[model samples]
Target: MSDLVWTRGVEWLAAAASDPRACKRDWDRGEGIALLEAGRFWDVLSVPDQLGLLTLDLLWRPTLPVPGPTLVDTAAHRVGFFLPPDPDSKWIGAGLRHAGEGSWVAVPPPYRSTRFLEWLIPPDGTGELHSPTTLELALRQANGSLSVLAPLCGG
Candidate 1:
């Protein structure tokens, strides 16, 4: 189930973008998936309520490297989820960071801010697309449930 969840998340990320060229898989060794775009790195396979989204920039390097994923706890605190290099295990994490050229910002809770914009998942209870602020608010209100957070973020 973990592997499935992780894989699904990666798939969702690949599908989220209208331009397939924007999503590139640098590595997928059954242990985890590594995606890249515009020289930025996104390595976490995040499954929020069956919606998959990847975190970018935290693991950028010139060589193959594995950075731990972020995991939100029940207390709504964000932390890292490091996993051993195993093919059969799924590591869950919280608070995905958005990384770009020499700049990175930690995504706020999906229920509190609307700065994290996503083009994949639609807004909840409304047909309108999600804005970054709305997604952050949703994340804050989700109590660390990725299932709840992912949808609001358009994953």
Candidate 2:
């Protein structure tokens, strides 16, 4: 049952790839990650891992929002959260990057967790994604908190 869910989830993510067949082929060949185009299925909000994790903590507090797919790239020291695409969307934060129209993001298969690039929150094959507004709020709060503490930590 779990295998089927993961398989479906991978299929759901592969649709974002420029070439779904090639993406599947790379996964079959045991490649660690594949680059998938954004804007077709979803957009990505990327930030430094520390701030991203803090934002996640804030997002989970009080009550959980509908969970969305998230990626962590330890090698790049970045974390990416998937959100429904909005062509004109602009995100503002100290370390935030918006990958919306005409952007590509490296993604590991939903069932795979590579050492560097892996899923922090895997898709459930339901095509659900994070709310951009909610994510922005959490990111804003986290960024503010981190910035306020940076000097204290001498960072």
Candidate 3:
């Protein structure tokens, strides 16, 4: 949107989990990397997926390796990672910014004791900054060989 500095054409992204345990829960159910941010509670920006429209979760950079097809946002200081659709899902390379209330809810990075939170430029009240990382490097880190930081999930 005009408000935020985000990159378009990013193939995919990953965000910090609202509940780390939930990520494990969904993954445990065979749902690879699904998040509550990707569910109906948030006004998700969606693209076409194998199932239909895969609701994309918000992230600036990735703290954890999101093993799937993905794109990166160079701005926002890579403060988080955007969760992508499934690896095989074909993204349309397009999305719409949510404008109405209760749409595009806060999808923060995993909480930490040391790091401080930052907002999207042109600040919108959202979640805390977890591990801010660019999406492209994150993909490489996820799939390729790169030492990276692990995602946090508060206990």
Off-target runs (Cα >4 Å) in candidate 3 are: 1-15, 38-155
| Better lDDT candidate (1, 2) | 2
lDDT of the candidates, in the order given: 0.32, 0.86, 0.28
Worst 10 residues of 1 by lDDT: 121-130
| TM accuracy, model 1 | 0.22
**Number of clashing pairs, model 2?**
0
- Compared with the true structure, model 3 gives a TM-score of 0.21
Q: Return the top candidate by TM-score.
A: 2
Would you give me the overall lDDT of model 3? 0.28
Tens-digit lDDT string for candidate 1 (34-113): 22331133322233422222222222334423333333322232232222223333333353433333332222222222
Clashes of each: 31, 0, 17
TM-score of 2: 0.91
